[model samples]
Target chain A: MTRYFEDLEPGDVFETSGYTVKKNEIIEFAEQFDPQPFHVDEAAAEDSIFGGLIASGIHTMALASKLTVEETFDMIANLGGRGMDDLQFHQPVRPGDTLHVELEVLETTPSERHSERGYVTYEQRVLDDSDAVVLSLRMETIVRRRPEGQTE
Target chain B: MTRYFEDLEPGDVFETSGYTVKKNEIIEFAEQFDPQPFHVDEAAAEDSIFGGLIASGIHTMALASKLTVEETFDMIANLGGRGMDDLQFHQPVRPGDTLHVELEVLETTPSERHSERGYVTYEQRVLDDSDAVVLSLRMETIVRRRPEGQTE
Candidate 1:
């Protein structure tokens, strides 16, 4: 069932399954997108503040988005993302860490100019196995509205 | 010559070389991190609002970060990213489009608690070959302070 804009209510919550962070994957992503010592070079990371190789924050953000799409947003009438706000990286994600996402619908506003679409704001918290939030952000997306009188 | 916190001043601007966006890379990244049909499937994208496959916003963000790190941040005594705010994607990034980044230092603040480090805030604008701003964000990062009396 496709979830339209009207189907998402503020305070609605969703959880996604876990994804294990791999050392090689982290290095590969970092090399391609970040390439910082703490994220790519294990030996150099030992001397940095992290003390070990860690996943790039960008990688963490991507992982969070992936999980949300696979488990929740894939079923929605999502047009695309509008933007993000208040993006924060709270903890370093290590190679052995397993991560999951908790998504809360924060707001929904029907587009004044477009009758067929609306905006949905969600607070996404990416948490590690220990329940600590590794990353958090507020994401705004454009979603199609259900046709009038259509009950699916 | 590493650029320490003390070396960065507000209004310092750096422009990066361009990166050509490839169709295969876009699909591969979307497949791994954001498997929305519009981002990963070309045929499905034709029917979507965009009318074509588009790079995932997360992928664009990563590309911006990569360009910054490679062209500018690599020479800084950087610790790691703190966070980002006001992230906006103004336009959809298409395959074959080349992208570049412009980073402007916005603020610098010495860490009161950690004297050896401080924070540098920058406004990053990711532009395409047409000179349109596709993505923009405010990024904050921790940077090591220059050692006292070390003028090299």
Candidate 2:
């Protein structure tokens, strides 16, 4: 049985595997979508305002989402989520920057109308090897609750 | 000529052409990346919590980026963005959700080091057919300033 609302508790934390950012991946992702000079060519990036190539913010966010799925895909009974908040690019993540992610359960509450479901809030944080924060996001999602009448 | 940093004043607004969201596009985007049940299968979504298929939030954001690019690609220096803030998914956008985007310049600052470049912030809003806001975002971008030595 999948974990539902009753299984989640405040203060739960999940640590994710880290991944290295490759120069080619960053360049390709930005070229087709972002197309900014700094994100396209390494040499061109040095002359641009950022003074170095940086990973596209979307790529970083997408990686974080993948880590979340890898950790909780089976246990999760996810409904949907509010968009991210307080997203800051603290330091530019270069080609070699390895990103590690963590998610913390912030709050939980039962839905008013749906006794079979509840809502949860989480703090998703991404950090570099030096433990500097790269991005932080807050989200809220709905999850099913184990029904009172059934004990599974 | 493209609008430069010096040309943007607070309250300046730009509206983009409407675009239709196709089912295959949403499904393909979600399946390869997002992989959420509600985003992948219409029938499965109907049996699931959401009651129908929905676009991934990231897909909506990317579409918004496409709209922004179409409107300003040639006009701006395009130094990439600081981050996104105040993102809200007011309603679930299914296939055939025609979307139009609007952006209003909120602030501008000249670059101290780069005489030909500066930064600007805009309040971006996306609405659906009924004029309801489907997404709201705030963005900061870097754009080239008209050359100080030039007389226009």
Candidate 3:
């Protein structure tokens, strides 16, 4: 889905394929990056406030970032990103959790720096199998404008 | 630093030791996660707008997350993050870029849902060797309140 800035309208919603979090993968990612007990030690995590092994927030973010590109977000002309805002983690993502993502276009602004590019801000939500929103944020992306005669 | 919610003042600022980005690490990260052409393929990246290989934004987030725990954030009371807002890729992170991070406490709000915990928002910035901000975000975290008679 190579979409251009001009092709995206505010209020457009894009959904992604489901991704499952595995227990080992959670620990692996945590050990390699986050390394917190709740993330790396299953037994310790069970005794912690989280009640069990939980995926690191960065892992969740990586999944979201990957889905944002795989499901939509025109990659060919995707200039890059400005940043994300108002990020909230509502729930801890556990192993066996199957996650789905939704990206809703919130606003679009023509680029002041380049006529060939513009900024698209989206509200990205990561929902668990139970449809609970585990994570949400407003992500701003730099996407290219459509060139003449190009269709995507 | 064992910081509790009450210990985190809104104006508090913390700096982190640097982490250098490696070319192989960047490719490995992208291969397992993002897998974008510009992120995974060096030759493809050379022809892209970036003009060379670049680290995935998610990779940068992961490094920042690791440093947050290793360098500053109070671990014992550090409940996992809620989410990040206004995450921006201010500059492309290239191989060999030595990155330093700064964390500034933005605000603290006691949790209405749970009296034992509160939310602390930090503005996290990753600056390259040149002192240019490459990535920045507002990260929200849930931290436990100090127990009675606890001293740190």
Candidate 4:
């Protein structure tokens, strides 16, 4: 597991690898939450505006969260986030599309309380096999600081 | 069913008064998508970072979508939109927090290709019983033109 906020620098990067975007997962999630034609059944997708199965934007967003959890080794006690900006589905992420993601720290600040923690913001992006950008988001998270006696 | 885009004017207000937020719904939705301690089980919530079961941010976003749809009455074929800018949880939306919403038109413009249609952007807010602003979002939707082929 990576160290906490006190250890994160503005330029630090964390990569999450080996996650696959499965079609069934996309369909199921979309059916429940999104329910848009292009995101549910394949036949319905064929007739929809997208003309093929496209992952629901919300589903993609959730998967990014899952990726963050795995890469962060479940270290942070997530206090939610400030939501997202510039979220774009540049290209369709279909089933079998292996996902690779990197989160780079953009900024950090000490929290109001000196309770061994600080806040860090990251610019996260997910890419597919062809190096196409599938998703991009900005997330702010609170992380524990190194113990008072710990070394750098 | 309420009116469509062309029918909505600058000062118009629409509300979805029928839906009430239930605890079980929040728990179920959170368990599947969010799956955080504060959002899933009540007992787990006691030990959670959040004091009690809270709705997932994504689910809150979806509820906003449902209210918007109820207002639009399927008149517009929604193109995707720019993602949210600021999303705050405010007071955690517990079950039984009846979700009532209201929206105001912020701007409107014509679509170049579809002379019979145009796009409208609105500032939507979701409030709880105490009328606290629990959630707020901006939506830009394409709306069909009135029979007179209005120009704006």
Restricting to chain A, the TM-score for each candidate equals 0.98, 0.88, 0.94, 0.86
Docking class of 2: medium
| First chain of candidate 3, TM-score | 0.94
Ten residues in a row with the worst lDDT in model 2 chain B?
B70-79
Tell how far residue A31 is off in model 4, in angstroms: 3.5
lDDT agreement with native, every candidate: 0.95, 0.79, 0.85, 0.69
Relative to the unseen true structure, what is the C-alpha lDDT of residue B11 in candidate 2, on a scale of 0 to 100?
A: 94
What are the runs in model 2 whose C-alpha is more than 4 Å off? A150-152, B109-119, B143-147
Off by over 4 Å in 4: A22-24, A41-44, A92-96, A113-117, A147-152, B1-12, B18-32, B40-44, B70-73, B111-119, B141-152
lDDT of 1 at B89: 90
Give the per-prediction TM-score of chain B: 0.97, 0.92, 0.94, 0.80
The lDDT, on a scale of 0 to 1, for candidate 1 is: 0.95
Clashes of each: 0, 0, 12, 1
**Candidate 3 true-interface contact recovery:** 0.75
Q: Candidate 2 on B1-152: residue-level lDDT in tens?
A: 66778788999988888888999988987765577888888888898766999888877877776677767554666666777677788888889999988888999998798777788988888888887888887887778788768644
| Model 1 interface CAPRI class | high
lDDT at B47 for candidate 1? 94
Candidate with top TM-score is: 1
Candidate 1: count of backbone clashes, pairs at least 3 residues apart or interchain:
0
**TM-score to true structure, per model:** 0.98, 0.86, 0.90, 0.77
Query: Candidate 3 has what TM-score?
Result: 0.90
